[model samples]
Target: MDIYINKIHYPINNLGAGTRLGIWFQGCPIRCSGCVNRDTWEAGEEYRLDYEEFIRALLSFENLDSADGVTITGGEPFAQPRALLELAGFLRKRIKGDILVYSGYAYDELKKKYPDILKSIDVLISEPFIESAGDRLLWRGSDNQKIRLLSKKASAVYGRGIDRAEWKGRRMQFSIVGDSLYMIGIPGRGDMEKLYEVMKKRGIDFEHA
Candidate 1:
């Protein structure tokens, strides 16, 4: 039940609706270009906390009623699937809210590699971030990413209309050159201009380094 964390933020507004407990786990295999949390990509170089203590701190939320759910983000959660499975199992037995996980690993890979962990999660946001394919979407960074509900009942309702093929044809690539990040997937200059316009309209900060 031990977990390594980058940090914790209560009442995360941008990630999802309602208040969420954001647990940023450490360690990731995918060293994605333009990765925002580059510091968290290492395999094993961070502090760890006991499972019981981590859950205890999460439960200590003062406004439990307003808390929506726990978001298990990471360098990559599936990298330590056993720990995740244990935590999710414990939480499922004790809590009423949902469990959301973010991983650079795609859904298909997760299903094939660790179906047990998949079974324990309610929602999975999968796919590696392609800086070139970046879009002003709700939760995903690139068009290739997807949101899958692993639970059948939840999938029937919450997972409707989410398909990966819709974005497969889009030309996008992530590249890092001399400590600078750049995306080069727009169909044309006009498309790039339009995307910038949309980003501005939506108030998304796309100029991060």
Candidate 2:
């Protein structure tokens, strides 16, 4: 099997429960309006990764031991159900941490089509980002979105909600990968615009990915 990816990062602290591996899959059909990750909407051969090779790389990742879990996001991880399940199953067998996923599909939609994927994941943050709803709480852009702790592991780690206003759940983390700069984490309403202005001041066009 093979997979497509937008980017991958490690020690991501805000996307899920703790320091974790974040894999941003390539291609999303939801295309939520005002999405900050327009860069991930297109699926190109440039983003392809062999499933076996990807697992090898992950197993050998330098921070694998320290990572609290693995998060699959971007381009809607469920878009590639077969590959996603394979990846998740491999990780649970070879690594020692829970698995999380984000998807533009609602929980009911996902449950109907990809029950196996749900079983493979410990937590799921579901629904397309609702720009009008704002990123105020639950690490969601809209009130319609809900975070489901699908497994006992997730319940143990994130069963209780963290105080939203002061918590790091709504924050973004930046990293430089190869020649491109990447940002991970949820973006509040109008946050992308502010980021664009800041980057523009530095002569950066600010590619939205």
TM-scores for candidates 1 onward, in order: 0.71, 0.91
Q: What local distance difference test score does each model get?
A: 0.68, 0.81
All-Cα superposition RMSD per candidate: 8.3, 2.2
Candidate 2 lDDT, 1-209, residue by residue in tens: 78998877888888776789889999998999888888898889999989888877777789877789988898888888899999888877765677888899988988999998899888888888887774566556666677788888888887656324333446778898788878777777777788789889999885455
Instruction: Give model 2's TM-score versus the native structure.
Output: 0.91
Off by over 4 Å in 1: 43-46, 152-159, 162-209
lDDT by residue for model 1 (47-129), tens: 57777787778778765445677678877888778788887897677655677888898777888998888888788888998
lDDT value for model 1: 0.68
Judged by lDDT, which candidate is best? 2
Clashing residue pairs, backbone N/CA/C < 3 A, model 1: 1-51
Off by over 4 Å in 2: 160-169, 202-209
